[model samples]
Target: MRSHGIVLHSLRYGDHRIIVDIFTEAAGVVPFIVPQSRIGRNGIKASAWQPLALVEVAWQPNVKTALQRPKELSLWQPWRTLTIEPRKTAMSLFLSEFLYHALRREQENRPLFEFVTKALSWFDERDDQFVNFHIVFLLHLTRFLGFLPNVEDWEEGCYFDLQAATFSRVRPYHIYYLEPEESALVPKFLRMDLRSMRAVGLNHALRHRALEIVTEFYRLHIPEFPESRSLEVLAEVFE
Candidate 1:
């Protein structure tokens, strides 16, 4: 089937080949090959597979096989605001990498699609703190991953255990637990929009602690994710 989509992220294969993952509204997620995508600006231009650039898409399953091929690709727009800002650019990189790992092959998730697109639109539109964007995105993403804990568990003195993906009024043995001050951000997080997320004035310690909780959350849910490179980079950006 033919469709339109955007390159979520890509990885280099060998010396020049590239394996591309794209999110298509019409066909969900698919991987494409940009043979020798690295060497020639004539083909992919510059950083074409970076993130969040809309593109033309073409797809069809191989006969007698589940794998599909995505061809007929090109960028739909320049992503002027997303590409130009360093802060937003970093967010894009972080989110795209996470999504590439989280979203599986041949799975269709319309709501997740819309959530990401809208969040990107929010970032593209205005300048804001950019400090707390990842933390807010982590909470919002809980809805898509099916791991959002009971937010009403925000009882005082309780600990948040990222491994169990739950909240208990008692302190957990895991050092990854969130202290009361950090846990207090939950209600505020529940009120955040992607745009308003930037304005969230979480203290540095709480913000870093939030990121740690979210990353542990990802580890529990995503079996394949060994580590997130964006973790350190995002911390520096927030700092």
Candidate 2:
């Protein structure tokens, strides 16, 4: 079968092979075993497996095993800035890792796939004023993940209950809720798209807090969603 995919994670498998987890348009998250021989001047380059790299792949399915081998693999859309730019690269690493965990159990959803690909392409094409990109990306991603908070329900002095994915006038009975002040930002964030996000000026502290809340929101919704290690790297890079 042939499909386009975004590389989520890659690791050395053994002496001469590598295991790459790719989120494909046709199959959600799938692991592919790639031999060292494929990483050469005349074949698929090692860079093609890097985090967030977009590639076209052809592979035969094996009901017996979860890991499949790609027969034909090549770059689907070469990124001009995402891989080369420092801040964008950091965002890519953090997002790719986040998606690896977030989409592990995802099934084929063409709309979700299209959303991701288009967002990444938009991110890659931008050159500046994108420091808030990751935050906006995470907020928008919640929509496809089935736990998007109800921004329409937001009101003055309202709190956001992370566990319930709603805005309310009363504090949530549980600990997983955002204060009214922080909760106010949710509707604003939800209203932002990639282009308008740049207009919303956020300093380092506010940006970091927004990310923390969004990450925590994910943790509350997705069972066992561990903290992202690359978040620190991304913060430092943006700082």
TM-scores, one per candidate: 0.85, 0.97
- Candidate 1 regions exceeding 4 Å error are 37-47, 63-67, 173-176
Per-prediction tally of clashes: 0, 0
| Residue 193 alpha-carbon offset, candidate 2, angstroms | 1.2
- On residues 162-191, what C-alpha lDDT tens digit does candidate 2 reach at each position? 989999999988899989999999999889
- 161-186: candidate 1 lDDT, tens digit per residue: 76776678888886766776667677
Which pairs of residues have clashing backbones in candidate 2? none
Q: Largest TM-score belongs to which candidate? A: 2
lDDT of 2 at 28: 82
In Å, residue 212's CA in model 2 sits off its true spot by 0.7
Highest lDDT scorer: 2
